[model samples]
Target: MTNPTALQLIARSNRLGADSRNTNYAGGNTSAKGSETDPVTGEPVELLWVKGSGGDLGTLTESGLAVLRLDRVRALPEVYPGVEREDEMVAAFDYCLHGKGGAAPSIDTAMHALVDAAHVDHLHPDSGIAFATAADGEQLTKDAFGGRVVWVPWRRPGFQLGLDIAAVKRDNPGAIGAILGGHGITAWGDTSEEAEANSLWIIETAAAHLAEHGHPEPFGSVIDGYEALPEDARRAKAAALAPVLRGLASTDHPVVGHFTDSDVVLDFVARAEHPRLAELGTSCPDHFLRTKVKPLVLDLPANASAEDSIARLRELHEAYRADYTAYYERGAAAARARGEEPPAMRGADPAIVLIPGVGMFSYGADKQTARVAGEFYVNAINVMRGAEAVSSYAPIDEAEKFRIEYWALEEAKLQRRPARKPLATRVALVTGAASGIGLATAKRLAAEGACVVIADLDLERAAAAAAEIGSSDVAVGVQANVTDEAAVQAAVDAALLAFGGLDLVVNNAGLSLSKSLLETTVADWDLQHNVMAKGSFLVSKAAAKVMIDQGLGGDIVYISSKNSVFAGPNNIAYSATKADQAHQVRLLAAELGEHGIKVNGINPDGVVRGSGIFAGGWGAKRAAVYGVPEEKLGEYYAQRTLLKREVLPENVANAVFVLCASDLDHTTGLHIPVDAGVAAAFLR
Candidate 1:
């Protein structure tokens, strides 16, 4: 039988979590306490069902809950060693499982169990946290809610913190909740409905109080030279700066990136107090965990040229890295003085970067994380605004933040994460990826854990192809005509903004014309060369600049043709363009070798199945030239090959993967033929 209490709890959680005003993503936990029939004793026992570790409330299910015997959890204080050893209490939770234990208990399990209520909600609402992190939080709590809510001073979350909250609740019988200083709020009631209502009341009252009494502009007047640039100009600047910032953030490891120019972010960055508030950092543990202690703020004006901004950013990054290292050392030294061993330094790169006019860029191990990090920073911005209006923004002390950031429990959680995929951190861009070989290559790279950009002339088809691959985190689509230099550069910029800088590029956009020298027009020749030859050069040239800026080696692959080497009749224009692409592989490999960039080519003959070129009448034209029907052309070509196998788009895609795979790390300037066995096309 289903537990109605548990169902109601989930419903309440989803409702509250759906609104970012209520809580940020995975930033809160909810629990219901009720009697359940114990399978072993066949008797009723009090049980606690709460959202488990690392689960988002909006998407939570039964499996995402941690089910434990309420009595056992409440009894934890009997054996609680002390605040210094409170982390040990988390492991003790395993012994209190009601059955198979639905999910791993979060560190907040004690907070849920110790509170004397049938239902409890602990959330990081922006309004609630505003008062909680204000300099005069205690007085603000008394002024806003009077006797309805109590104020608890800042204490790192642990069993001791849970005990402190329980004590406060017991002392204030009429109170509905308590606002934790330098954190968020905790609300409880006799039923799920009551608890949810109480939570909302606190959030709403805080917001209303600020609206009625607080100043109109909390961030201060807009500063000179910091006002937002026009929409088009700001976006162009963002696109230009994204790659350089990504490179800096990825100094320790490859990370995915996200960009935002929302009004909240733009307005905050343009304010006079932006630098001071950002330096104080976020207050809530959830906020700092994702956003880091603080961000790297770019000091350039809104109208600064991209070239000057780039140079200044490089200098800023070096200083940011040094400061981050010093912070780690200071924290480590403090921990050692207390006779405790601190966790190893994680990384010295800033997770978030702030630009006055361009907005914010956040980095993380993946796109979702990066996006969520940005979301959290927005929440922080809102908190700052509200706090400043009511009183003054006050975050936790630096040492406390360091302790929480490097806690042993947090380190253990990180170690338990699943291993990364083979190409987990790599990003790739594939041109003409709406169909055929280009699409196949994009999909394959995505499957191997690479973030991919699907570039094609048609935006609709390209977006559809990107959707077919996976979520926006894994793939994105862009409209780009390879012949246009600006469009090609924009596509590369999209890659930089979407998933950091590029590590691989596949130039597969081409059209075929099977016409003899006498039948071919000058326009036909120009079109072929423009798309197949000049297109590859343009995309490569633009990508190379970014790769060089990143200081990370990359791979460039040209999808040439077997006709480049073979003397096929009636294919004059295509064959000439293909030959040009073949030479590009050699030329780029030689030029880019010193930078550790590898250039290669794939030669495929008559890929009839899923071939965009063939579907565009190239197959019929070739069949007429060979004196055969269009449907028989594939079989006819296969019969001539030594392996007697028809070539396919997937075959060419596989060859691209092979050339770029780590196994071929030392190989360069190579072309692999995917023609089954074309003796004439075989490299000498």
Candidate 2:
């Protein structure tokens, strides 16, 4: 908070930002103009603070607000004042910063400056967008709020639109706010509190009126909550179908699928008008730019095989892509007919996937994008239902939508962005991620920009690890006991839910019984074999099914040990289980090869620190067997190795990374030893 004026503005902005029903993801902006003394120079100057690009309103903070010289921005060279001003406005945004080290101002900065009010709040509320996009939107705008809100027709967001909005405001200074057709509503006040209350009044009163006038109850479903199904049932379905959808939707591009059957979406889908409404396009221009024209509908029967579902989804994907192409071309032709030069449009890719009888899926380059797209579609569905209740859902023309989608400002954003890491969009599941080699590998994968799911039996620890690793965009933790078929399947589903799909599975969860053959008890043998050997098979089997369905090659890596190749003294159960796991890797590689999946193994020894085995007192006993104290055990192994270096968890993780990397892109059914130099463990 700065001056009282700025504090009030920031408070109201943060209040609106906290609610998705108000300002979702990056879809809204708030601005307040006030006098502030320069940090370097004690002279006061008029300053405008607006929500910056790429910042979410719900989490809006002081830093997220871009500070700019108000007069400097309003005076920005509007070379094409009436024709276009986005380029110039953007340039002004870059150069007019009143403070150092802040994000770029929101694209609506020009419009914010033009408005005459001391405080302005803009939001894409469901109720507001529903009214704005209806067929009779202009008239409805006048009737719904009874002319208290001025109406402005759709204009591309920039200087000219700002001028048009200002003209409307200047002409009607008595109105509280104005609704932008096919966009959203903007309200202003002298105080931040008044601005917020005024904006709320417009939205809430509009919503109440719509409800009273029969706005189809939005979703019109029996369920009263957000959930689509019973908690267990929903989770089970997600687990069963996530990988299948992942493989199908990701055929050409790397897309992660987000599943939802919220009451809103489910009710909309259940409606008789659902199919028509689904293809009618997004309700607002901002969402339209992200969700494309429509979603792909798929028929998923309850008893379908994974293969059947995947094959059917693939067909739908191809058809969706083809239809999108036609839609774009038609829009382009229409633009030319209107004597307007069409901008270069990107290729058609279905952003939303509707699976009847199951739920909905949204796809994007990563998890967050997919989730945000899904949220927008849900809001859109509700808005459409509300509009359909009163009148037809009349969104902006295809020309206007094209303008928003391929606008030069957005294109510049694409160009200015940095290149993503090699595995930036890839998704992976790492078992035993709570500690040791699995933990190290999970972090490494996250660092490489792959969305990772840390699956471990230690549910709390797994989640803790995920938080330590990073954002939901990159990591999540799920409890998965690899030995249980149900648990393994659940783990895969969790991975798919968290990351949209799985491209790699690191089967590294392991256990050991350092006992001689005669000394190994039945419980020890069962536990060791079940965890190491059977767990590996269960996880690999589940992973292979997903990879096979994906039709895109994937990787399944087993964390075996050098003991698999060379059994040492007093190690029976551990060595045998590892050997079994190694064989299973080759078998999976052989069978899943046709599906383009690669199966590999990493054999690493002397991982003393950070491993569960070491924590469980295996290191001390092993050191006793080596005729040395526990403290010297690490050094002893290091000296015994050809390289005379310790075999660490990171070393094992590096080998895992190599197997998953493009270097071994063509190789499969191979084992790479991570020990410094083990001639016998080496693969010739």
Candidate 3:
């Protein structure tokens, strides 16, 4: 039987987490205390059910809660080794588990276990944290709630801090909650309903106080030259600069990128005090954990040209790296003095970038993470705005920030993350991806952990295909006509902005017409060559520039046809274009080898099903030429192949994956036939 109190706890948690004003994503925990029948003893025992580690309160479920014997949890302080070894208490949480326990306990477990209230909420709400991080945070807490909410000094979260809050609760008889200086707010009540209400009351009270007494322009006046560029111009500049910023951010490892041009970001970036406040960094641990200690602010106005901005950004990046290294050394030195070994440096590249007049760009290993990082920074901006309004905005000192950034516990959490997939962090762009081999290939790459861009002439179909593949962060659909240079370049730019940079390209867009040299029109010849031959060249040229600039090797796979090598009849236009694509693969492979970019090709005989070309009319035309029914074309082609197997779009997609797979890193310039056992189409 499920405990009703546990259900109520999850319900309360979801309600609190659903509101961004209550807490940032995955930034808070809630708990409920109740008595349950102990299976072993057949007697009632008090238990604590709290949100577990690394879970979002909004998505809290029964399985996500950690259950422990309240009596045993309260007894932990007796064995606690003091503040210096407080982390040891976290592991101790396991010993107090009731039955199978539940999810692993979070560090915040100590707070819930030590508190006496029947229900508790520890949240990182922007309104409450504003006063929590204020310069005179203790005084502000008293003023905001008139002593209903007490104040506790900043102490890194641990057993000691939990004990500190518990002592405050015990000392203050009527206090409903307490604000942790330089951290966040915590509230409790005798029931789940009361607890939730108390939390909201604290948040609303703090926010209302700030708004009533705050300055009208807390962020300061907009700089003369830093006014936001017109919307179109701002987005265009952001797209152009994305690749450069991505390259700089990938100094250590490749990362995905996210761009946001919301009004809050625009208003903050254009203000005179943006740089000063940005350098001070974020206060709450949850904010800094995602946004980093501080973002790298581009020192130019939004109207600056891409060429000039890119040049200056490079210079700023070099300096930023050096300063980061210095900061690490300072923390390492401090650790050594205390006889502790510092953790290895993770990366020196900035995770968040602030561009005046444009907006913010945040980077991470994947799309959701990148987006969340940006959201965290927005929360930081809100906290700063509120803090400065009531008092000076003051975050934790640099040394403390470094300590948390490289904490051993944080390192262990990273180590616990699942292993990366084969193509993890790799970004792929596929032409004509709305259907057929292109769509199949896009789906395949995404499954193997690659971020994908589905490019085709039809925007609606392309977007639908991308949606089928994954979420917006993982795959994006783009309208592109391979024959148009501008469209091809735009597609490449979209990939860079959506996923940081491109590492793979599939030239799969083409049309087929079954016509002999005598029957083929000039227009037919031009159409085939323009899409398959010229289109591939445009995409390759555009993508190669970004790959070269990124200084990371890339792969280009051309989807040619068996007709490229075989003397198939009545296919002059199609055959010639396929031959053109096949040779270009080898040529580009040799030329781009110096840059570590691999080029390869796949030759498939007849992909009838799911093929846009075949479905359009090529299937009937080919069936007539081969003296077979249109519906039986696939069967007929299968019977003729040496392997007696029909070639499907998935078969071609598999061949593409093999050519680009890491194991074939040294096998560039090779053409693998996906034509089953067709001897004539074999590469000589």
Error of 1 at 101 (Å): 1.2
Candidate 1 lDDT score at position 535: 98
TM-score of each: 0.97, 0.92, 0.97
Q: Candidate 3 vs. truth: CA RMSD? A: 1.6
Instruction: Estimate, for each residue in 506-533, the C-alpha lDDT of model 3 and write its tens digit.
Output: 9999999999899999999999999999
Clashing pairs in 3: none
Worst 10 residues of 2 by lDDT: 218-227
List the candidates ranked by lDDT, beginning with the highest.
Answer: 1, 3, 2
lDDT score for candidate 3 against the true structure: 0.91
List candidate 2 stretches off by more than 4 Å. 1-8, 38-42, 84-88, 99-101, 215-240, 299-312, 333-345
2 or 3, greater by TM-score:
3
Clashing pairs in 1: none
